[model samples]
Target: MRYDLKVPFAEKDQAKKLGARWDAARKRWYIDEGLDPADFARWQPAPHDASSAAVSAPASRRAAPAGSEGTVQVGSRFVELPRMCDCLPWEDCDACRLQAWPK
Candidate 1:
């Protein structure tokens, strides 16, 4: 399923950098199958109904989609979220690891 985002115009570039695609006809951004929705949490649409509560939950609190096998595509690459810190894909892995394991 294609998940649409509520991205503002000013943040379009950031959204694009995070792997969201522009739907010119709809004038919105979206992520296709295999791309983890958690990666675009900041711009996810507000839930309108009860079941949608899951959609608005924080990424860490949500489980991976069925059949994902623990990885998701971000831009042109595949990343292992379980191996790296839970930072957004665009964030520096080294920096995120340091923050996640400060000594």
Candidate 2:
């Protein structure tokens, strides 16, 4: 089975050295076939079994409850969001003020 590992920016070099290749479009590193995934297990997005299960399942979206605050699942894990920045209504708040907006 093929695996796409989540190599952090600082550890990209280490992952590459373990035989992971970059997929520029997806912005992730994937293990080449025949490479031992154990060498890059730390970067695996999910457990081997969970990854396979997620891939085989049909994807469907559901609206979260009103006023709910939590992480959103991306590929194999929950995506983290800042506690205060909900990405809505750019107001003059501490979180919004600290955000790095495009010039």
Candidate 3:
């Protein structure tokens, strides 16, 4: 399975250097199979089955409150909550576009 990395905007260039590729339709970056996920641990998406009700919630309903941290299950492992860029109103900034911002 392909895993999407939660790459921050500031690190886009670095990620590209490390071989991550962007999926324009999904607007996320993912490491190709056979690459060591550990190298891109920070960007790994939390594991959640697509069919699960929790993950199926509407975007606004699933958002984490401002300044609050939460956990997401990732392939049987849990990782720190993903952080979003503070630049609100994103303004088409590259970093903001790369983030999965709270609705």
lDDT of 1 at 49: 30
Assess every candidate by TM-score: 0.46, 0.44, 0.43
Ranking by TM-score: 1, 2, 3
Residue-wise C-alpha lDDT for candidate 3, range 15-47, written one tens digit per residue: 898889888876777777778878887766666
RMSD of each: 18.5, 14.0, 20.0
- Residue pairs whose backbone atoms clash in candidate 2: none
Q: What lDDT score is found at residue 85 in candidate 2?
A: 67
Q: What TM-score, to 2 decimals, does candidate 1 have?
A: 0.46
Candidate 2: which stretches are off by over 4 Å?
A: 47-103
Q: Write the per-residue lDDT of candidate 2 for residues 21-95, one digit (tens) a residue.
A: 887765667876789878987887765534333124234455667765586547766666565566566556766
Total clashes for model 1: 0
lDDT of 3 at 42: 73
Candidate 1 yields a Cα-based lDDT of: 0.76
What's the number of clashes in each of the models? 0, 0, 3
What is candidate 2's CA lDDT for residue 43?
A: 83
Candidate 3 clashes between residue pairs 3 or more apart in a chain or in different chains: 6-43, 47-73, 47-74
lDDT per model vs. reference: 0.76, 0.68, 0.69
Tell me the tens digit of each residue's lDDT in model 1 across 1-103.
Answer: 7888888899999989888899787667888887899999888877773323322456687887788877755775665455555567776788776766889
